[model samples]
Target: MAKTQKGDKALHSLFAGATAGAIEAFITYPTEFVKTRSQFGGKKEGPIAIIRETVKTKGFGGLYSGCTALVVGNSVKAGVRFLTYDYFKRKLSDSEGKLSAPRSLLAGLGAGMTEAVIAVTPSETIKTKLIDDAKRPNPQYRGLIHGTVQIVKQEGIAGIYRGLFPVMMRQGANSAVRFTTYATLKQVVQGTARPGQPLPSAITFGIGGIAGLVTVYTTMPLDVVKTRMQSLSARAQYRNSFHCAYRIFTEEGLLKFWAGTTPRLTRLVLSGGIVFTVYENIMKVIGNSGEETS
Candidate 1:
């Protein structure tokens, strides 16, 4: 019974994360498109300017240039994130016979790092290409499939993994901060609740949202470098994360590295809050069933 209940919780968590990711992708994809374009030095335009230019140049569908990759990437990313984190939480808690904050942190970090390897590389590759192709005279990829296949053929298996190191760094850091902070904050918020009362979804969502904002802002610089590195042509000059970061910093200045952060952070807040709230609620519903069955 206990094992069955655990399996149900895991399945529910995956479903919730995937649903939230899909919804958030549609809601915030334009911001993401703008952020990617700006990050790659395609346009220095603000979000509004970028949106206007994209529509003017590519039509209304322009804003969703990378929607396919975003959906697949985010779904896998969130699914792995929640599933692995939950797995770690259960294992760590059972091993110790208690849930510790550090255990949660480790779980989140491990989950993020793992997903970074499995999902982030190919996803970002497609996304970057789509965003960059938007301004090209003759676009290479008509969609995600074309783009991915082109990369595989032209650059080989290793090509799809471009900017992976920086991705791992950014995502690992982002998840480490996001999950650890969320775990700590959730406990703090729940501590003030009345005896036997559960923490509100709003509280959990709010805490997660704030953590997302902090993590994105803190890691924006690395994200910028990663985007640039990934957008480079297969024959382009730069080699490796260190070289890319150094060149961008030396040539672009410090503030340039943080370009598009405004839109990125805004998207994080709106999307993160909604996704986390929905995810927690879904988890709650599933958890209730598990409790009843137990």
Candidate 2:
């Protein structure tokens, strides 16, 4: 969706998007944690097993090991995504405020890339390392700030952006798939509705869920590689995203590329539903129908 009318200020998109992302991140964080652990490559553990093991060793709170960074990052990332999408969609849309699917895909790609570079890369590096640290006998960092400092001190600023390429690729494709799917479905669902009329929350959630489900299957390999490339050992283990994928394929077989699918699938579906529903409702309350700006 365009998320704002032509005259809407950029701050509206930022607040609404950040709120939605923070809500989704907190709600779905456990699944996210489990998903990361499962994606650690060479780990054959299923989501349930990972959860059980984490809880056994570190208690239930362990499932939220690296959540603080993600919540903050996701909030900023979501804000950047919506803001950038609104900006690009305005440029790409027709004079009648109609955006073609192709244009929507391009806009989404641009938004994803922006967010990946500005927010995701560094935050993800820290989050992944924190989760890995939790599994160690001797944890290196005390918290998010300390961990970030430690990483920067040890490896320079580049350390916190270890998987930049894969992150960009994965996020670009991910948003392209998701925004296209969601926008297309929203059009279908809103067929014949007045331009400003909003779909029911249930319908919006369903559409978002479907979008996420499709994205999960299509982008699983990229996500797997992204995870591996962001790990603390990524520099020594793999040279780049391609090398990471090659290693996973040759060492662990094709199925390994789908590692963490179940938890990720769960998280994304729920995340989609939560994010869109919250964003739309919040936008409505803020006096915007979130219509595409002409």
Candidate 3:
């Protein structure tokens, strides 16, 4: 019975992560479009203006330009993140005989670090092309597949991983901070509630939102550089991740490094909140059912 319950929990966590990633993709697609456009650093249009222009010129479908990649990449990323997190949590809990906040933080860090290698590079490559195209002249890559093929052909498999190091850095740190903060916040919020009672959905969601905001903002500079490097062609300047970061910092001021942060942060908070909330609820349901079966 305990084994069955554990299996169920694992399955539920996977489902929750996948579902959350998919749903968040749709919910935050437009903001992503806006953020991408802003990253190019051309015309300083407000969020509303950028969104309006994108819709008017590109159509509503344009807002979801890189959504396919986002869905696929994020689904895998989230699946790994949650599964590994759960795995770590369960392992730690079993050893310690309790689920501790520090354990959850460690689990999230490990899961996040793992996902950085698995998902960030390819996803950033595709997304950066889509976003960068909005501002620059046509660089020849049509869409996700074309861009991927072009990179592979031109630079070989290594091309696809142009900004991999920074991506790993950004995503790894983001995940660790996000999950750790979320666990800490959830515990803090839950503790405020009456004894034997769970935290309210609002509190949980709020904490998740805050966590996402912190993570995104903290890592926005790395994200900006990652996008720029990935968007470049094989022949383009900025040879590698370090060179890309150096060039961006040298050419553009420090503030420029954080361009498009507003929309990105906004998207992160809202999407992160909703996704985490939904994920937690789904996990709860699965956990409860497992408890029942046991």
Candidate 4:
């Protein structure tokens, strides 16, 4: 019975997370596209300029150049993230199901690393490649499948795992900070509510946004490095993650490490809010249904 319940919980998380991820990805992809464009080596153009130029050159659809990859990737990434987080948090918690902040951070770190290795690295690599390829005079990739196939043919399986280490590090820190902040904020907001009771959607959105806001600034540098490392030109320009970071700092200055902050901030804040709002509400409905059937 205990094992059955655990399995059910993991299934619930997977379902809720995937749904949330797909919604968030669809809603915020333009910002993601703009952010990536800004991160590519060029004059520091504003996000608005990038958007206008992309639209003028390739039509509005250009802003969604890699939407399919991101949507699919985020769905799988969020599913794995929530599933592993629940599993690890359960193990780290006490007998009474209470988890401290430190343990929560550890659980999030483990979840992030698991998802980074399994989902994030390859997904991000593909997405970045597609976006970069789209900017060329004669874009090589016609669409997601062709782009993926071309990359694999040119570079083998390693093509899709180009920025594995930096992605793992960025994702590890991202979830660690995000989950911990979200949990802490939720607990604070839930003070008057009964244990295990769900908070209102608005409160979840606010907390999640705040968590994302904090995470973006804290992890922005790593994100920039990850993007640079995963770009099509990375092999020619960068030896590795550290070398990438060093070049950005020494050549481009410290602020260059935060190349796409504005767009990333916009996307992530909305992403965190939308993802948690959707996930929590879905989970609540699932829980209620389970209780009714049980």
Candidate maximizing lDDT:
4
lDDT of 1: 0.76
Off by over 4 Å in 1: 94-101, 193-195, 287-294
Could you tell me every candidate's TM-score relative to the true structure?
A: 0.90, 0.95, 0.87, 0.96
Query: By the TM-score metric, which is better: model 1 or model 4?
Result: 4
Give candidate 2's root-mean-square deviation (CA, Å).
Answer: 2.8
Off by over 4 Å in 3: 1-4, 41-46, 92-104, 134-143, 233-235, 288-294
What local distance difference test score does each model get? Answer: 0.76, 0.87, 0.73, 0.88
Error of 1 at 92 (Å): 3.2
Model 4 global lDDT (CA atoms, 0 to 1): 0.88
Candidate 1 structure, TM-score to reference: 0.90
Error (Å) of candidate 4 at residue 50 is 0.1
**Candidate order, TM-score descending:** 4, 2, 1, 3
Expressed as tens digits, the lDDT of each residue in 1-294 for candidate 1 is: 989977877788788887777788778888888888887753367778888888998898998997899888988888777778778777777554556767766777788788888887779877887888767878888898888888789889887788888888888777777777776766666566633456566765687688778888788988887888788452384777888878777887888779889878978877767777777777677664211100
After best superposition, candidate 1 residue 224: deviation in angstroms? Answer: 1.0
Better of 2 and 4 by TM-score: 4
lDDT for predicted candidate 3 compared with the true structure:
0.73
Rank order (by lDDT, best first): 4, 2, 1, 3
lDDT of 4 at 202: 80
